[model samples]
Target chain A: MSEHTVRAYDRDLEALDRKISEMGGIAEKMLSDAMDALSTFDVALAQQVVATDQRLDVLQREIEEAAILTIARRQPLAVDLRECIAAIRISGDLERVGDLAKNIARRATELVDEARTLRAIIGLKSMHDLAALQLKEVLDAYAQRDAERARAVWLNDADLDALEDSVFRDLLTFMMEDPRNISFCTHLLFCSKNLERIGDHTTNIAETVVYLASGAPMPTDRPKTRSFGQAEEKP
Target chain B: MSEHTVRAYDRDLEALDRKISEMGGIAEKMLSDAMDALSTFDVALAQQVVATDQRLDVLQREIEEAAILTIARRQPLAVDLRECIAAIRISGDLERVGDLAKNIARRATELVDEARTLRAIIGLKSMHDLAALQLKEVLDAYAQRDAERARAVWLNDADLDALEDSVFRDLLTFMMEDPRNISFCTHLLFCSKNLERIGDHTTNIAETVVYLASGAPMPTDRPKTRSFGQAEEKP
Candidate 1:
């Protein structure tokens, strides 16, 4: 390939990275908006978050198309191929993050209708904050190709899982204490699971980063502190 | 490109399809074994299912590497590019199917400890069979590039969702009726959710098949009947 061709390849890859970062940004905002809507019961904001998921979905498809086109045009080998694949994989995870956030926002609408707030709501808020923070860090890691930072976020996922388990147990207790709480707590349980799922997606991005940088496969199991004995853990 | 080059490209694409079909077969077996373990409280079968997930993960990575290499080596364009991308996408979905099956199997271990069986188990078994059937049909559609069959599977997903919802409601009732059933019902709930997720992945493949055949983006929403009123329908 000519020097000019190399430059064009670099530019294409840069655009791919930028598009993925753009996706990550949108996903982050969607999550934040969804949480705010959950906290404030802003049905309009929740609706906006739900509507915005279409954008994320569009961006994902666009990235896939562009990546395929670049591969067809450039015939990128080895690292270049890995980078393109990583972008595709990471954007996919980010898109799911958006979808999960939309699901959470949908739950918020129901929660607002069911009750103003519940006892487990406070715990969910904290979990959401922590998860949002982790997502931001992981996205940064992907942008910077910071494997260590990505690994940190990946390791911290176990903490989120533990929190989720605690939340699940509390929701169960809440439902048992009062039959009226069943529907409400059930919604909250699903919301917490969604948040945890977002965390999982972030970790997936982190793992993709490690692969993009190192050209290796991520371990099947994350370094989770929790035992496998907990069957009621994240779904 | 020469005729020889075209032949090589065809051969690579054919291998990709065959690999995906192999993955789909393994995933189906895993789901079946997991369900069997759940039904019979076969701890060994459940553990075997869990162990086999690693093989699925390896196959997924192999598929990704080979597809990327093919993109680099052959530079597939247009429909060929679409075929390669579909293979990657389908394999990813199949890998998740394996993971979800493993999750269901893990729940089996807990379910066995909780109780031999319960009243709601019958509903769960039916749901599993329907979901498994959907998955099998969708896999066949993917292999044959039968968009019509894929569309049929896509529309059938709503029935699975309805069944899942009914199962969820029944489990909640069971949990509410007896405190001792709490742990057991929770596991079953997660198991049902895992099965539902498998159905979701199959629908994803169906959508990919549509795109590969039609050269168009899949519609964001499938032909879902029930109102979007339900919060827990899908991600």
Candidate 2:
């Protein structure tokens, strides 16, 4: 390739990276705001979180299109090829994070009329904080090409899963304490699940980072604290 | 491009398509079996579904790696490029479908000792049937490149949402009817949500089909019957 073509390829990749960072920032904020909305029953904030997801969606589409064009035009090989593919993969995980946040936030409006369960929200908030932190770390890892940081985020997802188990028990107790809490607690349950999924997406990003840095896939099996979607701990 | 090169590109695209179809078959069966496991409390069947998800994951990674390598080697343009991108996107959707199905199946083990709410399962059955049908239709659309059929799947997602609404109300009623039902019904709630998400993924696949056929992106806003993750109908 000519020097000019090489420079153009660098510019294309930089553009894709910039868009992914922008998407990461938006997705992180959405997760934080959605948790706040849930905890405070701030319907307006939740609605804002829902609205912000559109930007992430648009950015993801742009990144994907640009990445494809880069591949077509540049025909990058080896590591360059992997970077473009990583951009596409990471953008996808970030986009789903935005969707999960929107889903969490959308539940806030439903809880406005239901009896408040502040304690239940506390557990979900912890889950949110961990998920948000993991997301941030993974994005940083991606930006820095820090495979170690990404691997740390990858290994630490079990902590989030453990938190979810406790939260699950707490919410179940809240529901049992008052049947009225059933409807309200159920929404929190889903919110926690959403948070857990965010952690999953974060780990997905971390793996992508690892792959981008070193052209090899991570081990498929993550350390399992528990299989998700179970309502209770095993007896 | 040489005729031989063009033929090789076609072969690459065809290989991607075959992998995607195989994934669709596995995911569709997983969804069906998971629901069956949930309704019957079949722990072994659910375990089988969980194990099957590994195959889908492997296929997704293979498809992605192959797609990227194809771009690096063939540098496909226009419609060929879109086909490769569509395969990546559809495999992703299908892989998530497998995960969601595995999630649903995982809950079946939890419900083994709980009091059976066969009535609640009936409502979820309707949802599963609709989601399964949509999955089948969207895969058909993708396989045949039937844009009209894909559009129909995209439009029909609202029906799944409506079914979820009814299912939500029924589960709530059951939880209220018996405190013992709280834990069981919560699992059902997640199951229904899983089914709803399957619908969401089906529509995603539908959109990819439309794009693959026409090289045009669909509108961002789907016709939502109710925003997902909501616990009840609006007042």
Best candidate (score: lDDT): 2
Q: Candidate 2, A228: how far from true, in Å?
A: 8.3
Q: For residue A2, what is the lDDT in candidate 1?
A: 85
lDDT of 2 by residue, B15-113 (tens): 998999899999999999999999888999999998999899999989988987888788888888888889888998898899889888889977898
| Stretches of model 2 off by over 4 angstroms after superposition | A227-235, B227-235
Candidate 1: deviation at residue A60, Å?
0.5
Tell me which residue pairs clash in candidate 2: none
Model 2 share of native interface contacts: 0.43
Model 1 bad stretches (over 4 Å): A115-117, A228-235, B115-117, B226-230, B233-235
- How far is A210's C-alpha from truth in model 2 (Å)? 1.1
Give me the displacement of residue B215 in model 2, in angstroms.
2.4
